[model samples]
Target: MTTIPMYDPLSPEMISDPYPAYARMLEERPIHWHPVMRAWVVVRHADCVRVLREHATFARDPGRTGEEIPDFRQNVQMMDPPEQTPLRQLLVGAMRSQDKDQLFQEAVAFLRGRLTAQEPGEPFDWMATLAAPFALHMSAALLGVPEPDDEAYAEISHGIALRMDAGLAPENIPQGDAARKRLNELGESWFPRPEGDDGLIANLIRRADKEFAGSHYIRNSAAMMFNASYGTIFAMVGNAAHLLATVPGLLPELSVPSHVATGVDELIRYDGPAQGTSRTAVTETEIQGTRIAAGDSVVTLLAAANRDPLVFKDPQDIKLDRRPNPHLGFGSGPHACFGSEFGKLSITAMIHALRDEGLRPCLAAEPTRRTTATVRSLDVLPVRLSR
Candidate 1:
């Protein structure tokens, strides 16, 4: 085995196409100390799963071990087991147990509405034309945000993502901060007096005191939830579209609901929103013979973990219905995405809507990827819808 050269995620080459680097790392050193990132990089599927599953050993907040991972900055992502448990349970439990299929149909309807708005034979950037709007609206609906304010919230989410996805650029810090403040304010104002159908906001208000400190904490948690799925879902929609357009026969196979459901997992497994995540080692630990000191920052390489050949057969190739797929694209354990199922439903809906509309979208030009260390999203996708 050859030694893989140390590479930074912020580098230009990695930013444009990171799989090669990720592949190299998987072969040479699955787990090692990242000098640039100042974290222990875990790339293998099993190791990453261990890191995510053993919550107490590798704490998200690391407060128990004297590591000060702030909650205001990361919200639930920054919390540990006992603290994170109730909050996670509340959100997950709020789902309508019996109306899941009904929810799915509603989601499909919402996506079709957006996909049909595009004119055939005309070129449009998929990112802006459909992906962003659809994801943002769904996110707003999940948060129980009202109509007029949802649009404004989307803009705020965009600013926050610009600041977050790109490592919080120097010029973007203020905008991100202001967006946070406004979102917190919006959450506080809207949650106490939710109108129409009850959703995330109402649920948060109902359970805030039990899971969180107070209304102020609820406001902050809402801010993190607001920024979490909104933009990432936008990126995933475009990603799946790109794959469907580029990969032959995928468009047809993925059109089927069962296939679409499975294909959504493959799409996310192939190029999911989260490339990697940072966690602090709560205690002295050893992963595959490598010793990790307490307080070390562990960067779980989710992107690399998904492609580990040891776990999945033909990991590189995109097979629509790859079953037994345990990709860490959505993180794992306590820190897994709160709305993971909803994301899959939304993307599947996007595919069905596009296929149903006879909208065969093709990439007109080379799409641009988001230039960020953390965010792996297409900046723009120039697509032409056709017969």
Candidate 2:
């Protein structure tokens, strides 16, 4: 009998910096079942990619198998191919012809105005004031939420993010429940008749009315959209800013507006906000000669896979001009992130505005990191800016 290597997913060290554990897995036990988490961790670049792409072998839809994660019901990310097809098409088409250039310009203008209005010396939570708000507004505008003011959107968005980070803990369950209730209420109130339908929520409602007239479907779908747009976008902005501060000379390269757009990919690859994603195997399978049984959960470490030496030479270094950069930052396969372009555009806009405003960095403070079973992001980033 072959001795299977052991790994603990809930270990403190693994949570803080999972790369070491990932490396160990890649080297010795790339497909071992983790007894603690009751999941098989797929760590190598090749295996991760294969698992993501091959939906037949590794299932995304937990519902199909009567599997349920209390927090992730009705999420598009949890849906399999055929069921996900129509919804994915709707979202893709909504943002496909979007004028990214114009959007980026507007984002830059907005950021410039906000940063310029702030006093140079006084400390402000950059994540709260700048990155988080900017991401929320962008998502709100794109999703067609009633963006009355920056603060209003930020408050709702932040509340939702905090609720998600808390992850169904006894103390946090109320917040998540409250957020869902509030979002549903907002959706019902605003999308009553769809007179001024512009955002994604309105579009989804319209589609549902025209095609599938069901209250539960529309409400759950809208809630899922909110989770994706608000949470992921916030992470992208915060993570990019944090990376720019830590990586030497990366900011200067990003100063060029074109490079800002191009470099967003590199930033995501280097330190993507999404640390890992979970899937469950439906049948017995052998991945890289390691057998995994049916009904076992699998956590694919995308961040670690992105840094695999076999796939990317000098994997840790940031190369802004890396061509053919097929990083798993946006994930892969049927459930690949639909909002990837929107996220890239938002980050590009912020970087370009910072450069165009001739902003100089005054001080770099350590970023507060938010860790979870899935997403990774900065809780706060402190930066003094000079114009």
Candidate 3:
């Protein structure tokens, strides 16, 4: 019987490239218990799916472990069914009733115009100049924030991302708390107590009663929106570009809009932005004959599960037209991502715009990955754009 490696969630190497370590963990023991973190890792597809979908047994509340992952407070992502349902409904309804389709088209046009304005041969940090800014701007627009220039928007969004990516560390806690306060102040100033449902922010305020609605709720919701919009969406763009650039004959295939959307989905499945999510066991349970005790943390490795051969054939290979690609790239069950559609649209638009400009990514330097235990993303994807 091989002993499971004591995986340190905060290790730089683990954040840089976690797949190798994940594979080893899965191979050694699918349900390995982490002594240091006091967490149980679920690396296989079936196990991850079960844990995420079985909310009754596994809870999303980090506070259950007596340790709250920093900045997760009051966010819909951490809430259970009764609380989560209404919040999700309000958000989804607002998105649907609003002119989001038009907004998305406008965002795409803006990106294309900007890309066209750039010098043909000029090399730029695509992630910084294009991917990150575009995501931040689109998100701000979606949430009805003031239309700041892409650079300014990116700066604020980057700050928020830094705070979020820090997770629940003591040193980073102060920064995250400060950012949250700043974000709340900004949201209040920008969208000050509208009389009617004017925008996303206004809608959130209206939805909240005197009891449930307040400055804190509004601010935390905005922060969550910004994090989802900027962090995950930015990483999606980088991952898509990186994957397309490496795959033989894939860039050319993304010339069409439909193909662009399909390719984006494949990239998400192949190298999702969020590698895994942790859930705490609410009660004693047995998974695949492995006994799990209450208060145990289970980390579901989504990246590993996406590549599980049991669920996907040739899972490592990118298939642009992969049909029935039931991947948990957006997660599963009640806690599934609420902004999946927006994310897909953002990625597709960016890829299509890049393809239209005949821009191909030439890797200038190896990607510098963001340091986080739960998410897999690149900090700086240095690439030279070429025709």
Which has the better lDDT: candidate 1, or candidate 2?
1
Cα lDDT of candidate 1 equals: 0.75
Model 2 accuracy (lDDT, Cα): 0.69
So what's the TM-score on candidate 1? Answer: 0.90
Candidate that beats the other on TM-score, 1 or 2, i.e. the better one = 1
Q: Pick the candidate with the highest TM-score.
A: 1
On residues 141-240, what C-alpha lDDT tens digit does candidate 1 reach at each position? 6676664355686678767765653332467777877777776666666656535556766765665565463645556776677667677888788788
What TM-score do all the candidates reach, one by one? 0.90, 0.86, 0.87
Write down the lDDT that model 3 would get: 0.72
- TM-score order, best first, reads 1, 3, 2
TM-score of 3: 0.87
- Structure candidate 2, residue pairs in collision: 143-199, 143-200, 144-199
lDDT of 1 at 275: 86
Q: lDDT per residue, candidate 3, 1-387, as tens digits?
A: 776457766678787666677667666667777665566778789999999989888999666556654543566776777667776676666665556677768777867886777677666676877777777778777787765456655555555555543434446656656655665555556545556546776776676666555545546666677667777878888877777656777787766656666667778988888888878898999887889998877878788888877788887788887877888899998888878888888877776677666777777667777766555667787777678
Candidate models: Cα lDDT each = 0.75, 0.69, 0.72
Candidate 2 lDDT tens digits, 140-252? 67766665355555555555555543422336556666766666555555555468755566556555546553444455555566657777778777777766666667788
Sort by lDDT, best first: 1, 3, 2
